[model samples]
Each structure stands twice: as C-alpha cells, then as structure tokens.
Target: MSALYRQARPTTFDEMVGQEHVKEVLLSAIRTGRLAQAYLFSGPRGVGKTSSARLIAQAVNCTAQADKPCGVCAGCRLVREGNHPDVLEIDAASNNSVEDVRELRERILLAPLLGSRKVVILDEAHMMSKSAFNALLKTLEEPPEHVIFIFATTEPERMPPTILSRTQHFRFRRLSEGEIVQKLSRILQTMNREAEPAALQLVARMADGAMRDAESLLDRLLALEVPITLAQAEAALGLPPQEALWGLAEALEQGQIRQALADAQNLYAQGFAARTLAQGLLEAFRAGLYAKMGLGAGPRLESSEEKLVAAMTALDESLERLLKRSDALALELALLAAFQALHGSAASPQAAVPGKPSLPEFNPVRRQPPGAKHPLPEAPPQGTSTPTPTQGPGSRPQMAMDLTQAWRNVLGVLKINQRAFFREAAPHLEGQKLVLVFPEKASFHYQSALKNLEAIQTAVREVMGELEVSLVLQGEKKKVESRSATSLREGSRNGPTPLRGEASAPAAVAGLTSTGSVSASSPPEQSAQSAPPSSPIAEPRVAPLDEPPAIAAKTAESALSSPPLPGDEPPWPDDEIPEESTEAPSSRAQTLVDDPRFQKLLRTFGGRLRKLVQDTPKAPDAEGAAQGDEGSDE
Candidate 1:
C-alpha cells in the first residue's frame, strides 16, 4: 500500500546502511544513560537522518532492555507504526510558523501519556521561520526532565546559531555505491525477486548515493514481475546501452572520429536523449580512467590515462551544450566539435596518412648562427662600371678586391643615418683616395655625407684599410679644382685672411673668399713671384650674400669684439698667406663653401658660416658598430 522506500525504511540504528560514526556515538550515549535534553541530526537526503531521529525516540522510551528500541517491545512497535502517544513526529516544512512552535512548546510541558519520557522530532527543522526558532530556543536549551527534543535538517547552516548550539549535533553521510548495491540486494532477496549484478550496479549509480532513490528505481524495474536484466534496466531508464557507450569511447581513444560520430548518431536514433548519451560516454571514460589507475573494476580499455582524461574533458564540455538543447543534431555537432578539438577535423589537409610521406614543415625565416655574416648581394660583372681600386706608389698596397664589394661592406659597417646619406653616392677608388660621387641634384645627400665624413672614413678603414676618403659632385670636379687654383693665386697677391669678426670690406682675401668673389677695397700688388706654400689653410667663413653692406659691416664688428667660446677655432694670422694649396678644394671644407649648392643654402637660410666641427671617432670595435647600425635600421 505504501512506497517501496517507506516499506524498506530503517527501523533501528543497527538496521541503518552507513554513517557508523553517528550510530556508534548515539548508541554509547543511550546505553550509558547520558542523554541530552535536545539532539540535532544534519546531512544529505535519504542517508538515514529521519530514521536515526525516530530510532533515538524509540530507544529513550523502550521498556524491555538497554539495547534500545528492540523490535519486539511495545514502545518500539508503537513508534514504528506511527501511533505512539508520547513520541511526536512533526513535518517542520509545513508547520514552521510561530504559532505552531508556541503550541509545540505548551505541549512539551505536559507529562508523558504512555512512556517515561516524551520525545518530539522536527524533520526538515531548517525550514522553520526565524521567529519560530526564537520561540523554541529557550525550551530547547532548558526543557523538562521528562521530555526530549530532536531536530533534523539537510542544511544545518540555515538554522539559527542559538538553536544549533543548544542541541547534541550528529552528522549523517551519503552511502557509497558498494553499500547501496548491497542494501538493494538484501531488499530484492526479501521480495523473492532476482536481478543481474550489472542491473543492480546501474541502479546504484543512477541513485547518486541516496538509498531511498535507489530503492524507488529498483521498485520501478520490479513492476514487470520478471528477472531484471541490464537491457531492461537501461531501456526503462532511457539510457544508451553500456556496449554502445564503450564503443564510442573506444573510437574516440583511437582517433576514429567518423566511427565515434556514427555510434553517437545510432544511439540518438534509438530514442536516447543527447544528455543521456553524453552522460553515458562520460561515465564510460571515467571508468576507463579509474581502471588505468588500478583503483577499481571497469571496462578494460587500452586507452592511456592521458587519452582517457582528454576524452572526459571533451565529454564534459559537450555535456553543458546538451543540457541547453537536447536534440539529435545538437549531439552530433557537439561530438564533431569535441573530436576536432582532440584530433583535427576530417577535412583538414594537414592530417597524416598511414603509408604516404608527409609534407615537410616549412619555416619562412631561416635562423642564422651567432656572429655569422649575412650574405652580401653578388658583385656586378666585369665591364659593368663598378668601381675598382688602383694601387699606387708610396701608398699602402692593399689586396686586389672588388671595389663595389668593399663599398658595400663599408656601408654595412656605417651607422644607419650615415648609410642613408652615403648609399646615394657611387664609389670610385683612385690610387689611395676613395671618391664618393653624388648626382648633381642630390646636394642634400652630398652635404650630409660631408658632415659625416669621419664616421664614413672610420668604417672605410675597417673595410678597406686606411684609404683617403673624398666626396665630390658627379659633373663639377674640374670646375671645383680650377676655382681652387684661382683662389690660391689671388690669396697670394693679397694679405692673410681677416678674422671672422672683423669689419673689413667684402674682399677676395687669402682665406675669406667664396664662390661669388666680392670686389676687394685694396688694390692687388703687381708682384708676379708668388709666396712659397705654407701649411694647409683652414676654410674661411663668409657672410650671407643678400645682406646690405652696412649691416654686414656691423655684424662683422660685433663678432670681432665678442670673446671666443670654448672649442672655437683661433683666427688666422694677419700677414701669412698660403701660396700653393696641396689638397684640392673638392676634398676639403673650402669645396663645401664654394659650391653653388652650398651658396644657395646659405642665401636661402640667411646665415653666416659658423665654425666647422668634425666628429671624432669613439668606438673602435667594428662588430659593435655594425650591430648598432643594424639596430638603428630596424
């Protein structure tokens, strides 16, 4: 007439399936007569919390023996039949109001009707209202000597602290699968029914550690009135067969995605839901993992632990999706995505075949060894006008090499900014002198190269060994040379160059001459014999050409009176004029001031020529310089 779980409810502490710790403590307290005024039982569902509470009530009122609630005693029978006058069982879930608790408190004060003590059990005690708990708190803390109170709940944390602190707390635990299976077997034996071991195990797993749930599931299977089999159990529960799940897990382990998908689709077609299939496969993989660890019995799979774990992870990720949308196509798509995550998609071209040779992996960047040189571009062929160095007498004899290669090596060794300027120039080595010739229009490049001559010369010496370096315009070399000779002749006839700050008239003095020669205020001497050549002369600083004569004179006078700053060049002598200049103007500072491009820059910018400051070489390590250059280029 009643549910199977109620028919099989535990009647005594010894009859309970698990929670031996709770049973041992309660039994000792009952036998020693050290009973507390109130008791609290807390644990998960269907694991003997209510059963234990009832057992305690019957034990305290039992009259026959100290073994407590002997099944043959009148008090135990009345408690089991739910008609004991002194034992009261209240469902706190439905009667959790303050008025109900006030009535309970008034009833607890009355004497026992049929037994020596009155026991009150409040099941689901955590459902009681806060006010109800407060009303019951004083009585629970100090109750009548002839009465006892019991509170049972699944979540003790929800109960008020005052109520919890006034009771003797006992915690019940969920029974393991083995204990549940054994208990189910005993129950089936009592009913005179037979069940396969696999069927019992499946029922226990589905119960998820709750004895009542397991009993109910077993009772459903027994309604057929036939011996229970694995197939019948699975079909009744709407679960895929264990063999099908194992087959899918095997396919996944062996990287057979097609076969795995086929197996999943077959299960789905057989009326099994997606969530059911996913859960079954997950259990199968978990059993495999356990078997791999030698922990318990499971499907004896050949999959390694890592493969089983990976398969389990895939199943777990797909299980969430199956929960949201449980359909045939969704399950298939989930399986496919999981397969691709583990083993790449079937349509991927990169997958390896069994017999054919696999394609070699190609990396676009080739790593070079440390300190190895990057291969230079090939040298131009002969008669290609690539510059070649000429060995001359009284000069350092160098190895015969391609001048183009030598120039490239020098460019590579220079700093990034210097290389940007010098790369536009074509190199021509004449004897020991290396001339960098720029196009007539590339005056900026030519001027920049001249400013960075020291860095270029240092790099050249590293590559070609101490060659004199010169920069020249491609078509104006001859004109530059002739102009330098004429300037030297006029300078010999005149006196020495004036100081930069002097207020002398614009003149073709020995050193202060520019490209456009201004007329001299002093008449030139008729002496034909030239003065002997002196040491190399410094280049003159000329004023801007567009300025008025008065303003130019004033600027010169101000410059003459101002003190020279640190590192400033000393003024030239007033009487000693050089006669014959050895170095050509194109190779020295004079060439830069005399070039039309340089004059144009001066006129456009409207500024006098300041002192020329050459950069002194700092780093002697050529490799370090090359590395620094490459870093700047990047």
Candidate 2:
C-alpha cells in the first residue's frame, strides 16, 4: 500500500523476471550445499539485489524446503516481516564506521535464537570506510559455524581487493523494456486495474531499464486515474506527444526549417521541459540511426528507412555537440545546425558522419543545377580601381620581418609530425614573397615543406589574410662556394671542377694578403735566414708618398717592417709575387715589378706617373731654391 514497487517486490528467485543468470547460480549453490560464508551482489540499482539477499537468507534458514525458500514458512514470513532475530540487515551507508562494524561482529558471533542459522545482509557495502572494511575482513574470511554474510553494492569498484577476494561476487543486471513491461502487466492484473498498452510501454522506456522506476511511474498514473489511457499517462508524466516528436523528425528529413522551429516552440508551449524534448529527439534519432546501420528498429519509429537514415545521422551529430547544455537556446541551435547541415549544398559525407567511412557520405541537401546564376550583383572589374593615400615604408602591409608569430599560428593548425619540421624553418618576408628557408643539409625538410605547401598556405591565409609565399634552401639560389685558397688548390688537384665554376679574384687577393710571409713550400729555417737584418720586413716601416727622396725612403722602410693589416683587401685583383730574398731594396722592387697585380696597378696609373733617372727629387728641390733666391733679390 505504501507504493506499487514496495508492495509488489519479488520475494523469491522464481518471481524475479530478469537476471536469470544470477538466479540460476544462486539456485545451483543452494541445491549443492556449496554456500560460501560471504557473498557479494553487485550491479545497477533497482535490479533486485536487496530482494535477492533477503531470499538467500530465507532459503538458508527456512523450516520447510531444503533447496528453496518456503515463502509460507515461519522463518520466511519473519524475514519478509523484517522482524527476524537471527537475521541482521545493516545500511552500510549510514552506519559504516569501525565501531558499527565491531558491534555487528559481536552480534554475529551469537547463536541463532529462532532459526537454524544466523544471517547478515549489508547493503551499500562499498560505502564502508577503510578501517571498517578491514574490521569486517577477518569475519568475512573465517566466520563462525552457522553464520553467513551477504554484501550488496551498486558500485563494486569501490570495494577492497581483499574483501572481494574473500567473498563470491554475483552481478545483477538491469531489467530490459520487455522484462519491465511484463512485470508491470503482472502488477496491473494483481491490482485488477486496466491501462492502455502504450502507457505501460512508455513507462518501461522511461524507466531506463530500472523496474522500480517503472513501477513508481505506474503508481503515479494509478493515483491520477483508476483506469489509465495513453493520453492520461502522457499528461500525468508531462511527456510530449510521441506524435509531435515523429512530426519533428519528419520536418528534419524534409529540410523544413520553419516547421522544425515551430514544432519545437509548440512543444515548449505545451509545457514540455527543454531537456525532456532534447532527450526525446535524441532517442528518436538514435533509433533511426540504428535502423539505417542494419541494427534493429526499436518500439516506435514511423519514418521510412531512406529519410530516417539521413535525418537521424544529422540530428545525432548535432545533439552530441550541444546536448550538454540543456537550455532552450542550445536545443534550438542544435536542431538548426543539424537541419542546415543535412539541407546545405556544401555539407560533405565526412561531415555528416565524421570518422565513419562505411556510412556513405553524400550531400543530402538539394542543390541547384550547374551554371544557374542568381540575380545578385557581381563585383566590378580589376581595371576599375580606386586609389588611396600610400602608407609609409615601415608601416606597409607585408609579412612580419620576424615570422615567429606567423610560424606559431601556422604550426598551431598543422599536425604534430609536421609541426616539428616547420619549427626548425626560419621565415622572412622579402617584398611580396614570404620565404621559408631551411639549412642546405636538411633536404628532407625542404621537400616536406614543399609537399605540404597548400596546407601551409591555408594556415597563413587564416592567420595573415592572403599573401604570396616562397620556399628557399639557404645556399640553393646563390651559386657561391666558400673554399679557402689552399682548399681550392687541393680540390683542383683531387677532383674535377664543376661547370661554370670560377675562382673568385677577390678571394685570391684576400688569401695572399692573409698569408703575407713566404709560401708554404719554403722551409722554416731557410725562410728565417733569407730575411736580412735591415730588410724592413722585421722592423716597423711606413711609406710617405709626398715627402723628399731620403725622407720618403726611410718612411717606406718603417711602413714595410710592420705586419700587413689583418684582413685588409688588396686594391689589385690577383695574388702578389713573392721575393726570393728581402736582402736588398732593389730585390724587393724587382719582385714588385714581376708581380701581375702590381704591374696592373702601374698600368692603371701610367698616364699620371713620370720617371726621370738623372733629374730626381733633389734636382727639383735645387731648382725651387734658386727661383726663391731670384725672387728675393728682385
């Protein structure tokens, strides 16, 4: 009388409809006298776990039947009445402390007063604390004779491994829709009540495989009306009409946006919660999707196979993305997105069912014929342009000089493996070109960059609008090889020279200027002995071009003695000839005369220089003095 679920709860294994597997196991154990000291019953809620535990207790202590529970016996009747002295039931949720477990341990050790054996049932056993579980562990492993412990929990994962190892685990399953409907029908017959078949089916489906929830729903319906119908059940439960949900599915399949929105608004107008509507739509679509994939269609799906597949696939995808938000706006948006995706021309097969290749991806939305243009206005031609004031050079629109920002943006969109390669590349902007340069040695990276050129461009466009770009390897474009003069000679002697190769004149001059002393072929001892004591090569010397002959000679000696300026480029374009010995000034002059670069320098200034052997710098000085004396006398 308290409620249909409590009043009609099964008292024996035979009366329980679902969980046949568990019933068979418990029956076999009782028949064989293989009863374990501790047993764990685990599964989803409202699936007869507590009822099964009670039945087991009654079966073991009943005075009548040896194999099963004698429901009419004094022991079974006392168990059913919840007044059995020998059998104990504990709600572990509220009393799960170590003290409670210890008290139970003290009581469990006592002999049965009114039954053959003492039995204990602990419901929600997973709620017990670690210490409490440890306290119960020893009793569970080796209990006194004629004492039994049965543990029931919806969550077995929370139980300790030691507890599980000491007991036998039996799993209870949720009742199916058919099983729930059968149980509800049996209850209705017992109460001599009449209800529509559709109402019972709706209650079962809404129960979500829980028999107690279905019974509770049925009790609510019974309180509303003695004889219930589908309409009254729907009204009492606040469920939207199945007809309306079916209509919404039809609207989606037909690509009727106005109808879909109007149907949803109407459902809300009829007092259905937004969340309930979303769940209903999800179920309907889920059933259709299953049917499309050759899975069995559920209780009610009115739509045809062809249209159902498309509509359900679209709605299913949209709901997954938006169902977490159970508000009206979220539900509306989900419906709209699904509709548009199913009805739009650009929607691809992959977009329809992402990550599923077996489901053919075809555009469900109707499209216009090719070359059919709309009446909208077209843009003006490129020649008809408008001019604006020019931006300053520094402020000009171009890719950034340091492409760290752009590269990061680009890498964000690329796949993981591609990002590693692109990270090593350096980006620079030169005029209209966005150049990505890699080291010459990493040819693979250069090739990969080229391979993913389109993806790179797409990312760049996303980040920096539109721009032209180029790929470059560091030393690819400029055909310059940096080889030392010695290396050049070695390569020439060891291998064939490449086509169009030129030994740079500047490089040769730089080499000669760097190696200012005697050539590498000269012996160190002989080279040291060849230098004269006053050769000016050892002592510092300077050459002053504007001074008199004697003074200029001394300055030149000082200038020549100092080491050649480090890395100074020679004015001429070839190597200088080396002297056999720096013993005499004439010998040095002769060496300079024989050098091709020095001869070229002289030829370049031939018209400006004059040489007279007899009339030297002294003669010019004497003439200038005579002229000055004449002027003074006058």
Candidate 3:
C-alpha cells in the first residue's frame, strides 16, 4: 500500500548502502557508551542520514544483551513502529519557530517515559528560524545525561555557526553508481521480480546518486507486472531509446547537421519532450567523453576529445532554456550552432559531397603572371617630340613610367620627412635594378636619402617585387672642382693625399667625384687645371643646357644613336643610370614643386618650398692652390 522506498527503508547500519565513516563513529559511541549530547548529520538527500538517526535512538534504548537495537527486541519494534514515547522525530521544516523551540526545550527537561534515554531527531534542521536556533543553543550546549539530540539537514551551511560548533558534524556522501546498482539488485530480489542489468544501471544513472529516487523508479517499472527490459525502463521514464540517442550523437560527431536535426525532429514527433532529448544527449556525450578518456565503459566514438567536450558544453548550456520553454526548435538551433562552432559553416554535408562545385576560396592578394608587363602607356617612337604625361624636366623619356608611378605610391606610404627628402630624386629602372638619381647640388637630400636607404628598399620591394635599389648623385664639373679644393686643403693639414689604393675620404663621395676623368690618382693641381672644363659627367647636363626644346624628342634617339664618351661609366658600378639632364637647381626644383604628387603633399602639410637656393662655388684660396701645386710636384 505504501511506496517501495518507504517499505524498504534501511532500519540498521549493516543494511545501509554507504557512509561507512559515519556509521563507524556512531557505532563506537553507542557500544562504548561515550555518546555526545548533540550530533549534526549533513549531506545530499537519500544517503541514510535520517535512518542513521533512528538507529541511534533504537540502539541506546535497546534491551538486548548484545548488538544493542537487535531487530527482534521489543524496544526496537516500538521505535520502528513509531510508538515509543522516549523517542521523537521532528520535521524542522514545518515547526521551525521560536514558540516550537520553547515548547521542545520545556519537554526536554522531563525524564524518559519508557526507556533509559530520550532521543530527539530534527530533520531538515537548516530550515529553522534564527530565533528558534537561539532558543535551542543553550540546551544543545549542556543537555541532561538522559537526553540525546540529532539534527539532519541537506544544507548545513545555512545553519548558524553557533549551532554547528556545538555538535559533532558528520557529512554523508552520495553513493557511487555501483553501490546504487547493488542496492537495487537486493531490493528487486526481495520483491521477487526480474530485471536486465542495463535496466538497473539506467535506473541508477537517472537517480543521480539518490537511492530513494532509484527505488521509486524501479517501483514504477515493476508495476507493469512483466520482466523489466531496457525498452520498458526507457518508456516508463519517458526517455527516448538509447539507440536513437546514440544515432543523434553520431550524426553530430560526423558534422551532419541536417541529419542530426532530422533525427531530433523525429524523436519530438514520437512524443519525446525537448528537455528529455537534451538530457539524453548530454548523457550520451558525457559517456563518450568518459570512454575516450578511458574513465569508464561507453559507446565507441570517433569524435575527437575536444569536439566531444564542445558538444557536451553546448547541450549543458542550452538545457536550462530547453526546460523553461520546452521548444524542440531551440534544441535544433543549439545543435546547429555547436556544429558550426566545431567545423565552420562550410563543413555542411552538401559541401562534403563529391563532384559538387564548392564556393571559391578567398585570396586577398592578386599575383601577376611571369614575363607579363604592367599596363602602361606605349613609349613614343624615335625622333618624336611628344612627351608622356609622367615625363618632367629631370625625367628620362625612355624610362618606363611605371617606376615613377610606383615611386609616388611608395612615397604616399612613407613619413612626411622621408617623402620630402626622396622627392628630389628621379626614379629609373634598368633591367632589375632601380635607380634614384639626386641633383648634383642637392647634397643634403642625397645624404638624408642614403641614411634611410633600408626603409626605401623595403617600400620598393612592397610595390615592385624583389628589385635592387641604388642611390646615386648626378655627377657634375662643379662636384669635381669642390673635391679638388677639399683634397688640397686636407693635404696641407694632414700629409699628402693618399693614392687610389690607400684609404681616402668617405667612399660614397670619392665614388661620385671620380666618375669624371679626374681619377683619385690625379694630382690635386693637375686634376683641378686639366679637369677639362667639359668632362664626360657634363654631357647629359650640356645637352639640356644647349638644346632645351629638343631634349625630350632627342632623348630616345640620342640613347640609340649616340656613342659612349671616352671616360663614361656608371657613377657606382652597382647602379644603372638612365640618360638624364642636370637642369639648373631652380628649374629642377620648380618641376618637382609643380608636380601633382608634390602639390598634394604640400596641401596636406599646409606648407611650401619657399626658396630654392643653389650652393655658389667658393673661389679657391691662394694658399690652398699654392699648397696643391707644391703637393702635385712632390
């Protein structure tokens, strides 16, 4: 007539399933008669806390000669039947008030009515009010020798510290799955019914370490009056079949989002609740994770450990929402989101099918074919005067305009000062080498450009793949004169000027001045006088100064028709120089300032190149010239 859990409640310590430590302590106290006045039992529900309390009451008052509370004794029968006057079981949840505690205190002072001692069990003791706890604190601290108190609660932390400190606290733990299964097996044997081991294990898992819940589930299944099977257990619990749950898990593991969703929808159509499906899937994933980790036995899963963890986490987070709304669509959406998280949207079944055209992958960079030239304006024919839009006073007509445009683009990405310094140089590409030619008089710009040569080379590489860069100063007769004067002054201060093989001034300066016929080996006086007022370095500048209007027209024709000068060569052997003219500093400065790129830079910075000053040739001092002649004779 009663529930199976109540009919099969544990009445003795030996009959209890777990909590060995709690039992050992309590049993020793009872046998040796060293019991404390108060005891606190705290743990999760259904782990024999209340039963242990009842057994203590029966044992302390038993009339047996040995194993006090012998199940056959009259005192034990009286307590078991709830008829003993010396023993009381209080439900603290309902009678938790100051008045209830005062009444209990008043009754505690009286002697036992039927046994040698009085036992009081307060269940769910944490539910008592603050005032009630205060009222009972005094009695619990120093109670009569004949009175024993036991408090059981699922949440002992809620109780006041003052109350917890006055009693012996024993924590009860949840029974493992094996222990619960063993207990269920004995219960089924007592009921004279048969059940599959899997059915019992399922019942134990559903109970979640609670023996009362497991017994209640087994009771429900037994009412069918047939041998219990896995299917019957699942049906009785309103859970989907294990096979279907495993199928859904497999689909998700294989990245078959559509198939998994369809399987879930089918389960929903068969009257399975959303919460039930989610719970079942959570268990399946947990089992698979455990099996992969070698923690326990479970179904073989091909999914990686990370994916299993992700799937489990997804189901767990969505379980609360699923319970609140009970919507099947929410579960499906959670599955889809989880699949996408593990393997992006492109991992859908349709994309994995063979012979199907997949979407093109995205590539951020566009590469050109080998030997293909950039789209640029065609070079004008020989003997033509027409100039391309990119050509200016210092620009060469035969050089491709792409290099100039690329240089402008590179400048756009550099700092303002770098752009300003390098803007004076003309860009020319010969073969695979890039040349930046600075004006003869713009020595400051050329030196500044050289210091930042690494930055310039990097920018060049970014625009035009892998190309060598060279910085060269436009050679001139004035440069040669300055060098001769400098050498004479240095020879007078230090010793005679070193020969070509000896160390000299900076290599870059020597490389520039020696481009003319006056080599480093030439004596200062002779090189200064016989430097041939017109040297090969002056050829390009002479053409521009002599015939300005026909320069662009003759640029291509002269390169093809003209022969090399006697001492003509690249200023730096590593660099290639395009045919260029050394226009006056003022003219060259005007050409750069008027350019659209320079104009844009000026507008951006709100400034201008106010004056273009050319360095005037200082006349050589008489002493230095005399010293140079003496040094040449020596």
The TM-score that candidate 3 achieves is 0.54
Q: In candidate 1, where is summed lDDT lowest over 10 consecutive residues?
A: 607-616
Give TM-scores for every candidate, taking all chains together and pairing residue i with residue i.
0.54, 0.56, 0.54
By the lDDT metric, which is better: model 1 or model 2?
Answer: 1
lDDT of 2 by residue, 1-634 (tens): 4777888878777898888888898899999998888899999888888899888888987889889997889999889878999889999999999999999989988889988788899999999999999988888878998898899999999999999998999988878998999999999898889998889988998898888899899999988646898888988998887767767866776777789888998887777877677767767666556766678653344445544555556666666655566666877876876666556565455675543112111112345644347644454545764543432344334324225555677789888877776776787765445678888877789888888888788877776556666888776744444445554654333222211222222222222222223324455455333322221112212112233444333322332333334443454544544436656755665555565665444322211111111112222443453333233223
lDDT of each: 0.71, 0.68, 0.71
Residue pairs with backbone overlap in model 3? none
Model 3 scores worst on lDDT over the 10 consecutive residues at 607-616
Write candidate 3's Cα lDDT for 129-178 as tens digits.
99899999888888898999999999989989998888999999998989
Off by over 4 Å in 1: 293-301, 344-634
Tally clashes: model 3.
0
Alpha carbon lDDT at 218, candidate 3 = 87
- The prediction achieving the highest TM-score against the true structure is 2
lDDT of 3 at 491: 41
Give the distance in Å from residue 274's predicted Cα in candidate 1 to where it truly belongs: 1.1
